[model samples]
Target: MALAKLKEAIGKEGFFLELDLADLKSVKQAAEEFLVTWEKLGEFTSYTCQWCHDSPLDQFTVQGYDLQFGTNTLGRYYFTMLLLPALQRTTGTNMTGKKARVINGSSIGHIDAPIEIPWNVLKAGSEDSKLKG
Candidate 1:
């Protein structure tokens, strides 16, 4: 299976955790589980790719935010904040002798978005407003 291959490729130390960023509850739960499972977190990386244009109109997060903004931005923020304590624990103890980092990957398409994003529209789940912005 693909997962088996991934594990093999990454070696015995690499691990994967299931997370659904679209759901705030899931993000909170995953962060809690990660803290319990891993005493020290060296790096927290999130690679959510929800193209703003490709997002569906009908889909919305439980908090009523636009799916793309909720999943790609808010969810990641919440999850990272939740795991901050664990990350802080690794401050000077990293085996690599480097500071811990949180990386969130964004696409080049983000450059095309309006410089001033309409936060109200996004929070209100207005897909049309998002497109216009």
Candidate 2:
């Protein structure tokens, strides 16, 4: 659905790889699939995790890590590492001959994030979870 929208707006067919940032396995597969299709990465954009859980319960991703940490930290790190080679190939692959740069995007909401990681929150049903500011 998102690819269709992009195609309609750009008037050109594009590549799309299904990604679930919450799962490490999904991130690895997405990176692999993307590298298989594209030899070089001209531009790659990675954004911060935006999932917000308000159910009064600690949520865990399929990999058994905190949903947000798994998606925001683990998932992004793994995906970027796997794509490093493709990114490196950008030096002479693009018209501008520029190397690909990884961008860590964030929103204003980050200002309210805890200064330090609360270890207990990383596990599901860890009622002791408390975000330290």
Candidate 3:
């Protein structure tokens, strides 16, 4: 398994989750798995925010959200909420002796954000060309 191979190579505890943020189920499952596996976390989940230019049929998340927004925004948000308890447990235990910090790093995603709200793309089940959701 990928996790086994990663452990073999680095000898550190990690898990490989088939996480699909658009599918809230996957997000919840990933959180549950993490809670079972680890207790403390300095959380930094980097969700790559982008508006996909789907050249084919438009794609939407399993929960009928724009794939990009659902995964990049909602998915990570939900994941963090699920892990809040663990993060709280580790608060003030870190080397800095301060409370835990949750960092969501948005890397240059704003530049690519649509100039205007493409309502067709934003709404669930709305149709558009090449844009997912």
Candidate 4:
């Protein structure tokens, strides 16, 4: 449906990609492919991303890191880091030129529950009650 609508809307050829954001390897591969294609064509406009990792798992692990920190924050951070160069190239600017905005999909939950916890809770291996914030 989206493809048909896009074709109708554009009245020309359009490319669409499907991806799973939960997988780091997939994200990395997609970034690489985008770079290679952009390099070959020598034309790229901009890179945009909307990051949201609000799914709370009982316990999830990737590369031996906790899901909350790994998925909600760190993964997005690293993915942005890896793709910075390509994004810069896309916009025809160096790293220091324009600020590459990373719009985090932060929830009101953070503000709603303002009770501060110790930093160690974030670092501690145990996902205890105190760390549930």
Best candidate, lDDT: 1
- Candidates 3 and 4: which is better by lDDT? 3
Regions more than 4 Å wrong, model 3: 1-11, 53-57, 115-120, 126-133
What is the number of backbone collisions in each predicted candidate, taken in the order shown?
0, 0, 0, 0
- Per-candidate Cα lDDT values, in order, are 0.79, 0.77, 0.74, 0.51
> What are the per-residue Cα lDDT tens digits for candidate 3 across 2-120?
77888899999676666778888999999999889888887656655555444123556788776777777888899999999899999889898888777777667566556885666
TM-score of each: 0.81, 0.80, 0.71, 0.54
> Which residue pairs in model 1 clash with each other?
none
Q: Give the number of the best model, judged by TM-score.
A: 1
- In candidate 4, what are the lDDT values of residues 1-133, reduced to their tens digit? 8778888998976665443344577667766765666542223333323223443424443454445555655556666666677655545354445543445555444553337743443433555513443
Sort the predicted structures by TM-score, highest score first: 1, 2, 3, 4
lDDT of 1 by residue, 21-128 (tens): 888988898988899999888887788778765556556688878788888899999999999998899988987778788988878878777799767667654546
What candidate 2 gets wrong by more than 4 Å, as runs, is 1-5, 51-57, 125-133
Model 2, 69-124: lDDT tens digits are 77778888889999998999886768876677888786665567678877877876
Q: Where does candidate 3 clash, by residue pair?
A: none
In candidate 4 the C-alpha lDDT for residue 49 amounts to 34
What TM-score should be assigned to candidate 4?
0.54
Error of 2 at 25 (Å): 0.6
